[model samples]
Target chain A: MNGVNIGVLAVQGDVAENVLATQMALEDLGIIGTVNEVKTPEQISDIDGLIIPGGESTVIGTLSMVNGALKKIKEKIANGMPVFGICAGMILLSKKAKDRVVGEMDQPLLDFLDVKIERNAFGRQQDSFESEISLEKIGISKFPGVFIRAPSIIESGKNVEVLSKFNEKIVAVKQGNIVGTSFHPELTGDLSLHKYFVNLVKTKH
Target chain B: MIPLAGDLNDAKGIIKENIGSFGTKRGTSTLKRGFAHMLKNGVVMDVTTVEQAQIAEDAGSVAVMVLDKLPSDVRKAGGVARTASIRIIQEIMDSVTIPVMAKCRIGHVYEAMVLQETNVDMIDESEVLTPADETRHVWKWDFTTPFVNGARNLGEALRRIEEGAAMIRTKGEPGTGNVAEAVIHIKNVNNELRRIKSIYDDGDHQDLISIARDLKVSYTLVEQTASLGRLPVVNFAAGGISTPADAAYLMKLGCDGIFVGSGIFKSDDAKERAQAIVLATTFWEDPNKVKEAQKMIDERQSMLGLDTKNLELRMQERGSTA
Candidate 1:
């Protein structure tokens, strides 16, 4: 597989980690591809797939929306460009997001995935932790789920695929070309989820 | 998750430390460093009040650090500076939806414990406050709270990391509103990192050990820093930053992020300057965008910078060598 350009939204947050993980995933699968940090609409339009790394969703969503990158991402994902959102990214991709403590924060979102997300579902930064999880459908038996002030998918549409759960909470899900994980796979050394996304990007491209 | 109320002693290693580090590990290095990674490319602002915290959040700060006074004001009021009151911290935490951090005097364990008790997202073993212990910083690994510390060079940075700082920042001249010291500190760190990386690249294991001894840190940390060609944790520019260009310049120098201590509120136009600095920090690579950010504020609105050469309180030099 070649010429599959993957962009990690770089308005703010963990852009480098995702880029590094995508590069490693490509190397593992022996796929020739490029992973670029794209923030502007023009840069984002060139990518076949996108990965929104974990961060402060309010900051990322607000900044991305101000620069018009969020609108472009919404268009691309709607037209079948594969996208993977982690943590704050997952919150941005959902149809609706509310803060667990404050409830109903006013922030921008992609509105691509039909899910109701809870920002800081596990609680605050002090509550951030890691856990053993399995993405069974993606052929990974066990993975480290690094949750740092992470969000949770409280509800999902009928079409969404539940990929993993922790303590009976929805942590990972996939709907068509869009995938989201409340836990950060890039933070850990696991390349399974990233590789799976790469395979999807390669196939689609 | 068990709750420890009014019991500070049991809070140590509480919350089921074994949060899975691959397998059966407690609060693994990955979890600590991962916290820093999530904050990359973002601006964390210093706030003294609930109003300022709201301003910072509105300006897109990744986190707001609660302080007793602005660093500039702290320098002006030369008494023993300590952590902000728990009431104010909690108020700010309640007010903002973003992560809230607080500063404790360097090596002040009780202060850190109290801040952790308040449930601040992170504790700063900061030198901006008075150093509580002369020769020892707080042993951070004993507590579950992640920490960020200031460092003037690579040796200090590595030592803080060894002492369990999840994030590192330049110990620039606080309250001065000058980026010169921060520039010097980051350049020193980058130079040292380059030295070790070249040594590692040349396969000179013997030289790294000698350098580690000179730096007064461990060989393993030196090797790791060298191998990565960067710090094990996120390194943000801190202490003295005022202008949008100052932030963008540091970002161009390879800082993962920035902490504007007295930059925003110390100036005449707090709201506009805060937004401009955030914009400059996020789009640091693009000069045209930075130019637009710079034009957002007037020159008269900038904080009056102090001469670093004449300052009696060289905050960067305190609580370091340990």
Candidate 2:
């Protein structure tokens, strides 16, 4: 494939690291692409794919909306633009997010993926831990998953394929062109998830 | 007061004409001016909603902070950035006229740039929550946008100011919710400034720079820049500033203003507390005003569960890593 432009949403999240991870992932697949930071709605249109890094969901959602990228993002996704949302990004992509201890606090969600998430299901920051999960269903073996006050998929639609699970909770899921992960694959130094997303982007293109 | 506008303007013109005659450096005057402004009008607000920003405007805060959630929430959420949603920021901007600010991860300049384009008055380069890139501190000098960064001490504060920051703030170390750390930083900076002043008379810009370099502090750049005739813009104190007294105390210590995250809304009487903080910062030196402010603060104040010592230890740990 020709050089693709991959953008990492720079709206109040882990932008640079995601860019680096994506760059690495693309390189592993022998793909040529320019990984740039996309902050505004205008910049989003230029990218072939988008990565929403793990961050605080509320801030990311608020910032994206404020920057006028939310609607644009929905449009792009609807038009078959591949999007990978990690952690809080996953929360934003979900149809609903239950605020674990707080319960029922309404947060603005993107509702792209037909899934319900339990926000902060892993407890607090100190409760953050790592685990190896089988992505064999997606044709991968063991992958390290970094869960930091992570969200868990409580429900998924029939179309949503479970890619990985931990402790009976759906940690990774894919629905059509939209991909969501409750754990941070980017932080774990794993490129398979990113590689898979790139393949999705290539196929869609 | 006499109409000193003429004299001030004359002095400004002379200073401008002889910018080279002063033969100083870049950041001295700028830091001084910023420090002075913060002393005069400092107001901190709890920015949970657009409505809260209006309250901040009504109370006459110099700047408004947009948070998706409060410091307490950040702690509970494991250092997540939950401030005003982008929609909420739009609402808040529509509601108020003062400078609107938001927090993002350190080194997340892309977010800062986005906020800048959204017409946010400023961006707080603070670790109010966990940084998106937890491994590094965000450097603000790289962007064209004006930023106000949080500093744990005078050195850190001065460094950000030197790095093209329009403003500087003392980090209050949230979660613990105590102003003791802010107090210490203020005292340390003040003492350091006094020492710097005593060592050099006027026009000893080189000496000042050397001292700052030797100390490996940021204020050295402030001294160099100020000597070159740049005026400091603004400096504020943030983090554990909960009450009007706390706000007043920082103002007295030479902070330009105060930013209260969980301090205002976390209390039972948020409005009253917010009002009192406004009063305290505006009339910081008045004993009677202080007394009244204290009464209002006392009425609304609750025990903050912050362990200052533990936070200090964490700062030390983080600093070492940084």
Candidate 3:
């Protein structure tokens, strides 16, 4: 493989960790790629793949929406460019998201993944936990799943493929080129999932 | 901030080594620190009531820090400020979907415990309240809930990180509606961070060790911070951020986020101001967008600004042994 250009949506915070993780994932896969923090609409159109990291979903969406990057991202992902959305990212990709505590919210979302999400399904920050979980489909076992005020998939459409779950809740799902996880793989330092996404990007690129 | 590849690896190594042994699996450092990361690039507003919490949520604040009174009011009242009433905190928590945070007097562990019991999302070992223990801070490692501590410099930041804080914010003089102190604090922290980064790059282990000694933090933490060229946790700007431009300026200066207290509710158009600040914070890199945000709120409605030099109380100086 020659290389791939990867972009982490850099509208808000919690993005650096994803960039570092993807960078390592590429290096580990023996693939040469440039991982860039991208915020503009032009940058969005240029990436081979994109990762929307965990942060405040409202903030990321609003910022991305303002710069017209959200429109470009939706186009890119819809056109089969690979994307991995984690935690808040997972919410952004979902078609619908309602807060467990506050009921419905009006935050912006990409509405591409064909799933309904419940934000903060695991309660608030103190309830945030780290657990060993299985992502056997990706060839990893006992993966450290870090759920931080995480979301959960409440409903899945016909095309959604459930990848992983915790406590009987849908936590990770995929539909064609787009992958979404309610837990943060970037925070866990386990590169397998990231490597999986990088390879997804490579194959698609 | 993006760090060197080695620094990221070192952090990962640290996370891998220390995760499962932290008293229980439910609330490890990884979980705590990661919680803070989730709040990056957002605004956290201080709220005194459920109404304010709702306003903050509607305005797109990532979290709301419940307070018994606004910091300016606390300072004006001239009494020992303590943790907010648990009832009020619970009320605010129930009213909003966003994470709820509350401030405890610096070094008030039991207060933190009560907030944790109330199931608040995070706690601030804030200097905004009067310090219950002037020379010490709550040993935050014992709590399942994460802590965000205020720091004026790198040593204080690393020390808080050493004490198990998941986030760090500038201890700008709270209630003053002044952004100058926050600016100075972040500048100082960044300056010291760069100094250490240079030392680490030069491979001057002895100086790193001595500098670590001077900072009163663990040498390992100093090494990791130097290697990372930034604080290991998210750093937000706080205290006196009163307008969209104030928030945007701090975001431009490299704060991961902004914490607004009196800035919002104290202003004439609290809801509009809150929303504008959130917009400015998210789009700080684009001046045109920031201008759009600034235009959302009237400057005449902003809080009366304060000068740090003339303030009777420098809250940033409180509860610091460093």
Q: How does model 2 do on interface RMSD, in angstroms?
A: 22.1
Judge the docking of candidate 1 as incorrect, acceptable, medium or high. Answer: acceptable
Clashes of each: 0, 31, 0
* Tens digits of lDDT, candidate 3, A86-137: 8888889889999897788888989898988998897887677767777777
Which residue pairs does candidate 3 place in steric collision? Answer: none
DockQ of each model vs. true complex: 0.48, 0.01, 0.55
State the lDDT of candidate 1 residue by residue for B170-288, as single tens digits. Answer: 99999899999999999999999998999999999999999989988878778878988888788999978999999999999999999999989899899999999999998899899
TM-score of every candidate's chain A: 0.97, 0.96, 0.97
- In candidate 3, how many Å is residue B33 off? 0.8
If both were scored by TM-score, which would come out higher, candidate 1 or candidate 3?
A: 1
Residue B277 displacement (Å), model 2: 1.0
User: Which candidate model has the greater TM-score, 1 or 2?
Assistant: 1
Model 2, span B1-322: residue lDDT tens:
0001101111211121112222211112222222223222456575878777767666556557788877776766664563356788877766653446777666676676676557554566667745555455555544433466666654565555544455666666674568888787667666766666555547576777776776565544546433422224455777778877878888888775677878877777777777777767656766677678768766535545587774433432233124
Q: Candidate 1: which pairs clash?
A: none
Please estimate how well model 3 matches the true structure, expressed as its whole-model Cα lDDT.
0.85
Error of 2 at B146 (Å): 1.3
TM-score of 1: 0.95
Q: Which ten residues in a row have the lowest lDDT in candidate 2 chain A?
A: A122-131
Docking class of 3: medium
Ranking by lDDT: 1, 3, 2
Q: Tens digits of per-residue lDDT for model 3 on B1-322?
A: 2221212222211222233332225566677777788788899999998888888987889899999889999888987888898989988877787788999888887888888888898999888888888778887877778889999888898888887788899988899988888899999999998999999999999999999899898888899889888888889999889989999999988999999989999999999898899989887888998899999989888888777797788788996674
A1-205 per-residue lDDT for model 1 (tens digits) = 4478999999888888889989999999999889999999999999999999888898898888778998899889889999999998888889998888777878888887889998888777667887788888889889987888888889999999999988778999999999999988887777899999999999899
